[model samples]
Every structure is written in structure tokens, then in C-alpha cells.
Target: MSIEAGKPAGLRERKKLETRIALGWAAIRLTVERGFDAVRVEDIAAEAGVSPRTFNNYFSSKAEAVAARHLDRARMIAEELRARPASEPLWEAVANAVMARFGLTQETRGAGTSDQQWITGLRLMMTEPALQGEFMKAGALAEFELAAAVAERTGTDVERDLYPRLVAGAVWAAITVVTDHWLHADPPVAIVPLLRDALHQLAAGLPVP
Candidate 1:
């Protein structure tokens, strides 16, 4: 039978969401407590009160759980871009959307204790080979989503027009460079300013020397 239009999700959807969330949290908690390599999939599943097969349904690997929190940011930016004023320049639209989704500010800081844990998690992900690979995959997915958003905003065909993909790649590359530099900074540094600098560099369109 055909499903009803706009019907609220029934038992199955809620159960699935609960299961996914449990698995994600379990994976992240384990990874945070131990290094990524030290945490096993079976352990994560058990911690989440699910079977290994259920964990596999939600995430392919433990690395994905750590990165899951950031995945929604790309989709959020895409939605914001889609709603932006048409008069805004493409770069401005994208920049505003991206920053709105990820820009950190002092007002948002909580107990300083949590900040240290977040920084530690980031450092671990940066240093872990498996997690880095997963991070790259997540990045590629974000780029694809961004390209589609750009194409929609610019009235270009995402597949046939090369410009959308090119712009998306350039933007992703700029962010990647900034993030890599931040990870290796001797004294550590704030990401917001570095990301702002990267965005400005893109806006100025300076040729790479």
C-alpha cells in the first residue's frame, strides 16, 4: 500500500534513531577513553546495548562516530545557502553559511574543562591514521553536498558545469590547509581566526605562488 503523505514516523523510525544515537555515543565514549586503535567494534556495540550487526548498520567504523557531530554542519550550511538572498554573491553566501554553521565564539564557551576534552579529541583524530582516513571521506562527502548547494544558488547544473565542483574543491582545500596548520601549531591556536583568514584569502582570489 502507498504510504500516507507527511505522516509522523511510527515506532520503527524512533527505535532506529535511538539505536543509532546509542551506538554513536558508545563509540565516541570508548574512543575518548582509549585511543581509537584500542577500541574495538564489538566493545562499542556491547556498550551501546546492541549487537555488532546493529552497530554496523549505524556506522561502518568507530572513526565515523567521532566525526558524526560535524557531518550535519555541511548539510546545515547547504540549507542556509539555499535560503540566502539571491542578490548576495556566491562566495559571500557560502562564507556566511559556513561560518554560521561552524564559527566559534566566546559566548558559546562552557565550563573550560569540556574544551580541553574537545581539543584532546581533535588531536587524537589528527594523529590517528585510521581516523584521518575517515575524516577525509567525511570531507569529500561535505564537498559533494556543498557543490550541489552552490549549483542550486548559481543556477548551474551540478554535473555538467565544472565551476561548482571547482569552487567547492577550492573552498575545501582552503579549509583543509588551515586545519592542518592549526593541528601542527606549536602553541596551538584558535580555529576561528585561522578560518576567517582562509576565507578572506579565497575572496581575494590571489594566485598561488
Candidate 2:
């Protein structure tokens, strides 16, 4: 793993994490200010005070940098879910794990970046042909990692057990839809509550009155 195993990040790893984080924030801030097309790789690197080569080392494109936080959330939720007490119900475990990850994003709304900035950037991606495809590709890879974590928690084989894969996929899909709905709402909703509510609904078998 890039962060190493069973130990805190060493100096090198910490610096690398800082760099990637700086670059990601810079990329998002710039693109939010000037749209995706108007922003260049060199601009992201400059904003983060690095060379274009350094930016290339971290992310191949701007969209990947913008989406890095989303990818990290997927990894964090899976790891947290695996660490949740086995005595917890499956859906309960996933709900708590996801909520914890959602809290992480709160502090990261770094300077000059607001809900509107992120929403505008996301909306722009929908219309412009950008590196968002790469972002989705990264998200797909992260989904499988989440499935493996679920499998371990349940003592199920990822290769042989359909249950783990199905649950992981559905959970992520629900999160995506619910998150988009929250973002687009006129009075934006808090994601953590929405996430918890949605997971509870899924746990209840999607029942309606």
C-alpha cells in the first residue's frame, strides 16, 4: 500500500500525501474558478507550487486530481467497515462506516471552495468532455476493494460469494444517487444524514407505506 502497513506514515510518505492533497485542492479550486477547460495542468502545478512534472507524477489529469477525495473516501469507508465490530449488523456496519467517511469531507472544503464550487465543477464535467472518465475508472477499481473488505468482515469469498459483491455494489450505487440528489437540491441536504437514512432504508428492504 502507498501508505504502508500497520504503521504511521513515515516522513517520505507524509510528504507525498501532503503533495497529493495540495495538488488535489489546487486542481479543484482552479477548475471551480475557471472551468475545467480553461484550467491547465501547468496551472494546477503552479497553484500547488510544483512543476508540471510533479503534477504528472501524482495525477495524469485534472479530473483525477479533483476526484481524488472521492476515491480516498471509498478506501476509508471500506477499511472502517472492516474494522467495525463483527457483532454489528451488516447494514449498520456499512452505515456507520459511510457516515464516518462523510464527516471527513467537511473539513476539506478548503479556502475559496464552497458547496457551489464543487457543484459547479461537477455540473461542468457532465457537459464537457473531460478526464472524468478516468475518475470513474478509478472509482470502479475502488469499488472492488470495498467488496473485498466486506467479504473479509463476513468471512465470505469475494471470488465465490455473490452476496458480498452484490451488497457492495448496491451500497455504492445508492450513495452515488443520494449524494447527487443532495447536491442538486435547492436547499442542500447534509450528506451524512442522507447517507444513514438511505442505508437504513436499504436494510429495511426498501419498504414503502
The local distance difference test score of model 2 is 0.78
Pairs of residues at least 3 apart in sequence or in different chains that clash in candidate 2: none
Off by over 4 Å in 2: 1-7, 103-107
- In candidate 2, clashing pairs total 0
Tens-place lDDT digits, model 1, residues 72-136: 45656777777788899988888887777774333332233264465676578578887777777
Candidate 2's TM-score: 0.87
lDDT of 2 at 197: 82
Q: Which residue runs of candidate 1 sit more than 4 Å off their true CA positions?
A: 1-30, 42-54, 103-117, 207-209
TM-score of 1: 0.74
* Candidate 2 local lDDT, 153-193, one digit each (tens): 88999889998888888888888888777768787667677
C-alpha lDDT of residue 144 in model 1: 82
Tell me how many residue pairs clash in candidate 1.
Answer: 0
For model 1, what is the alpha-carbon lDDT of residue 143? Answer: 82
